[model samples]
Target: MMALYNGDEKDIREFFRVYCNFFKEQGYDVVTFEACIGMIMPGAGALGDSRVIPVIQEEDDFRNYPWDDIPELYFKEYSKYFRALREEMPEGMKAIGGVGNGIFECVQDLTSFQGLCYIAADDEELYHNLFKK
Candidate 1:
């Protein structure tokens, strides 16, 4: 099995390295898709401007940060970035896309972890709603 990401190469490689190292510690050899395609910096989005307070840094440094306060352009640019990444994936490899068991992490990134746990426990409908969104 191989894992690939659409973000910074260092973070992606670190994730894969830790993933493989954990499995290898128990005896297994794995090849990551990033390793298959020699990457160094990868790509990142610039969804900040004067109107927006550069929520990316806040989102990265803080949890349960209010993203609803961000401008719609930020989300629009981010969605465009994601769409571009989706389009860039090899057609044969589309079916393999996902964070494996990290669905909750994806949700947290989309929403927030504190909100996610509440939705997971108190509002299944809203949880799935945000998840599909």
Candidate 2:
């Protein structure tokens, strides 16, 4: 997986610059997401701007990408990503998902407040359609 490094913090243009600078400062080779994006598209406006260029061609793994299937591929993709991130963490950050991290809260993020409530209220039809399932 690739990560966007925006300076020492999170800013757009500074990202590429910092990456290149990092290579020069360290006097070592570095593989950057910019290069990946460039290989993906030379004129990509931004890494996250999917409208213009796709950073990850795996649409099934994308969060907002709509699908005709009820169980979107993103659910599995995100679950794997989440589990991997959790498992790979260094001791201090290790923790298990509980109460606040349950399916309802996550579904709420996919569906807005009212949408989530409506779904939880047993309106499966409305919930399915509203969430693009």
Candidate 3:
């Protein structure tokens, strides 16, 4: 959650300035930041050592996923961070940032690596549809 939250935008711009300036003062030309997709996912611990349960083990799981809400959820959770990063970049400095997990990583996170391997064999269409989602 902290990764997605940059605090309240109006209240956090000053902190953003401070954050970017620290790296600039340290002789860095760019600051790096990212927001992970797992924040919005319902069951997403597959990326770490937590329980390896997968969210999309079947076609029904994929079909039932709230795909339409993802964009809105992402915007609400992370757009301000990107805006702040751009606005707060130091002079002569740039930023490196990523919005969320890529398709591969997201799918892997939604389905544990082992689960993905099973999906590949057990249900090819469901596996493909998971990615299509």
Candidate 4:
């Protein structure tokens, strides 16, 4: 899956062309594609379960985190893949995908699952606010 994110425009196009064919061979008219948003997060590897430390451990950590730039970061990192999928899809086939993980997963990626649970128990507001953001 990470392979789809590398290379220049021509490489991306070739990747998607082959990907779309793979789905077709499986007797499907649609292909699934998703960009991992967690990769764009400030400190991320937890999403891939690398056991790295969490980025948000306390209120100050959350406050200092760059909450506003995720979208741009995502586009910068993955928009080309989406464009390639669009341009390379076979005429009768379509692709369905968006960001790889949902809010809960993203939160857990930022704060370890245990840490999030602790926050929920100790700082209910912050726990809820994490989801709100």
Q: Whose TM-score is greatest here? A: 4
State the local distance difference test value for candidate 4: 0.86
Over 63-105, each residue of candidate 3 has an lDDT whose tens digit, in order, gives 8878888778888877787788789888899888776678888
Show the colliding residue pairs in model 1.
none
Candidate 3: RMSD to truth: 2.8
Q: State each model's CA lDDT, in order.
A: 0.39, 0.36, 0.80, 0.86
Off by over 4 Å in 4: 47-51
Q: Against the hidden true structure, what lDDT does model 2 obtain?
A: 0.36
What digit string (tens of lDDT, one per residue) describes model 4 on residues 1-133?
7666568899899998898989989999899999878878988655457478889888888899999999999999888889888988888988888898899889989988888889999998889889999
Residue 101 displacement in candidate 3 (angstroms): 2.4
User: Which predicted model would earn the best lDDT?
Assistant: 4
Query: After superposing candidate 1, which stretches have Cα over 4 Å from the reference?
Result: 1-30, 34-101, 131-133
Task: Report the number of clashing residue pairs per model.
Answer: 0, 0, 0, 0
lDDT digits (tens) for residues 15-71 of candidate 2 = 434544555465544322211212222222222332443322222323343434423
Superposition-based RMSD of candidate 4 using all C-alpha atoms, in angstroms: 1.7
Clashes of 4: 0
Candidate 3 segments exceeding 4 Å error: 1-11, 49-52
Clashes of 1: 0
